[model samples]
Target: MRAQPTAKSARCTACRIPSRRVHGFYWRSLGDVACFGRPILLLIRIRRFRCTIPECPRRTFAETLPGVARLPARQTDRLRSVHRAIGLALSGNPGARHAATLGVPISRSTLLHRVCSSDADPIPPVRVLSVDDWAWLKGSSYGTILCDLERRRVIDLLPDRSADLWRRG
Candidate 1:
């Protein structure tokens, strides 16, 4: 959909100072999730604002959408979240297939990138700790899973199952 922000003023991305003088606008294409059984592409009119502060480093900058999408994002945050979920559930080819069926056609590599780039949720303090070894190739390569016993959740995946870690366990 073609749309422009109705806000009277927008803050400079670099300086965070609000400006009403509109320098110009640029079109940004964002791949949003499907609607009405069809894929959605949003053509948003992003306003360019001249920095009112003379000392500010940026002379002109595009207004940010904040929670909607990142400045350099090609797809909406929600769509990326969906891709991340699909990747987490069934990474690589399987996830790409699933996403295509769901009306979000993203490449396997891109989907995997989304999953890796997504930030983990904040976890509570770990009162108790647990470690375990998992084989990457049926005992050929091993790694460690660090978990928080008090929260009953995984904290991180260590690359190696070292002897020091095993001794502590």
Candidate 2:
């Protein structure tokens, strides 16, 4: 299906100035919800508005449907949600297999990337420390492991397992 947006003016993202002049329009085909077990496509006629500010470097900007999809995105917002869920539920190969069965054709690498690309909470500084060592090549190279007793996780790994190395760290 095809549809033209009704928004005549849009605010400039760079300078925050409202633009009313219509430079041109472009057709963007987006993947929408499935219809009767088939993927439905939505073609939106997006308008490019000329920036009113003279100092702004951007000459024109395209209108956006905030809740629908992000700029330069091919899939719908809901489809991204589905991808995230599938990506998190199962790792790469298994996720891709399940996604294909569910009618969403996504690559195994893409699923793995999606799951690992999310912003993670920062780990705070550790107070109590636990030091240990393990051989790397077992008779060749050795490494030191520093763990936070409170957090119960490895804080850092040193190249050489020694008292001097542990003291320096």
Candidate 3:
């Protein structure tokens, strides 16, 4: 005979309540397994409950999955990592094409969004910096960029490169 699975009661990570009751079931697709070479799918029966405390802000919440990642996201954490890698390597149209070859469908605009959304730690402060100007619409408009030699990254962008702007920096 097979052992029957038991429904365990657990506290919510966000609300810190143990009064929640079982609510409903949902399906989630997990990342592919390297050793098994197969994708994992979780058929989870999530729990829901009303907040016993009247002062509590939230009234209802679903059971939390610590192993699972951001809620409502289609791809797993590993797949998101892969997408980020592709976005960094190729960038824009070329990156999208490369991702398609790797079985991940991505567009140039999507890649740009991902790149802009990255929240890596802020670069350290710089001592000496360089400013340069580039024409956006040739002979019509120009833009200026400030670069930090030590950080090796663009620190600021301005509408135009001017002596006043340099003094302000």
Candidate 4:
């Protein structure tokens, strides 16, 4: 099923700008919401709008739904949630296996890529921190990761796991 284009113009949640010029519309397949022990696929028609203000930094902005973001191929917010959960709960193969049950089709390598590609950085004034090392290519290459001990999330990844690197960081 597809959603119909309504008279309503969705406003940008980030910048609070109302846009009327829709670039295009596309259907996104979202996760199933449970109903009577059955899975229901949510077919959401999301709009890609042209930014009304030329002065705005972004030329085009997608209208965000309640839980989804723009430009991602996956339509389900559950996928992202599962990815994040897997990333935090377990590392390597185990995490990917766990994520599979949550309807996210990610491999171990994909999980690692997601972790390394993450742009989130912990804000400072962090009291306790954890430093650990992971082999990127099994003995050939290694990287050190810094984490916020309190938050239990990775802060940064360094190329080498060395005392000099830690000292410089």
Candidate 5:
């Protein structure tokens, strides 16, 4: 379906000035979630607002749809979220296969990219740590493994397995 912003005035992205005069409009094609077993594509008519401030660097700015989707994104917010969840649960090829089966029809690489690009919750600081020696080779070399006990995840791996190196870290 086709759509456009109905607001008469939009704020300039650079100067934050509200403008009623529309400089121009452009078309944006976005991928949307499937409906009734069919994929949906939305054609949005985006409006451009002129930045009247002489000091402002931007001459014109496109209206932003914060709730719909972020800039430079081809898919809608909810659709991308669905794809990201699938990617996180299945990962790589398995995720892609599952997405296709669900009628999302996204590639494995795209799914992975979506998952990686999305912001993750910030991890809290490590209060307790667990250190141990991990063998690089079965009997040839070894390394030090540092883990965050609170988070239950590996924090870092030291190249040398020497006691002094681990103590200094």
Candidate 6:
């Protein structure tokens, strides 16, 4: 079955103006979850609207549907969300294995990429800091590793083990 956009008008993203003039229509293929134990594909019909504003730089724009897949996205929104969760929980190789076992086929690299692309908030300001020194070449070069004790994450790695290096880092 084919689906069409519900909205009659779309706002131009570039100029921020509501446009009702239809430029054309196109078919977008999307991947969906299993239906009756079989994978499903959706062919959605989308409308393109011409910008009404005279000074608007954008000539046309496509309609967007809520709960559907984003533009240029192969899988559905729900599937992407599930993949993102698995990626965050298991990460990379483990995540791929888990997804395959759950009947959601995904590569290790894709899982890793999804996790890396997700929003990551910056670590909060840490009051407590720790420093440690380690050998780079055993009996030769050495380096210092700085950590935030409150956050429990590495902050920086300095090339020298000197006290001056610790103070600077």
TM-score of 1: 0.71
Global lDDT of each candidate: 0.85, 0.79, 0.63, 0.66, 0.86, 0.78
Q: Show model 2 residue runs off by greater than 4 Å.
A: 119-169
Q: What is the Cα-based TM-score of model 6?
A: 0.60
Best by TM-score: 1
Rank ordering of all candidates by TM-score, starting from the highest: 1, 5, 2, 6, 3, 4
lDDT string for model 3 (44-150, tens) is 45556555656668776665555444576554556566667778887899988877676666678976776676442246778989878877788989998888988
Q: Distance from true position, residue 69, model 5, in Å?
A: 1.1
Q: What's model 2's lDDT at 3?
A: 81
RMSD of each: 5.7, 7.3, 7.8, 8.4, 5.6, 6.8
Give the alpha carbon lDDT tens digit for every residue of 39-69 in model 1: 8999999988899999999999888887778
Candidate 5 local accuracy as lDDT? 0.86
Residue-by-residue lDDT tens digits, candidate 6, 128-150: 98978867888888898889987
lDDT tens readout by residue for model 2, 83-109: 778888887898988887777767999
Candidate 5 lDDT over residue span 78-162, tens digit each: 8998998998999989999888777787998988998898453346789998988888897889898999988789988888777
Q: Number of backbone collisions per candidate, in order? A: 0, 0, 0, 0, 0, 0
- The full ranking of all candidates by lDDT, starting with the best, is 5, 1, 2, 6, 4, 3
**Backbone clashes in model 2, listed as residue pairs:** none
Among all windows of ten consecutive residues in candidate 4, which has the lowest summed lDDT? Answer: 31-40
| Candidate 6 lDDT trough over 10 residues, lowest sum | 114-123
lDDT of 1: 0.85
Model 6 spans with C-alpha error above 4 angstroms: 119-169
| Local error of candidate 6 at residue 95 (angstroms) | 2.5
Score every model by TM-score. Answer: 0.71, 0.61, 0.49, 0.46, 0.68, 0.60
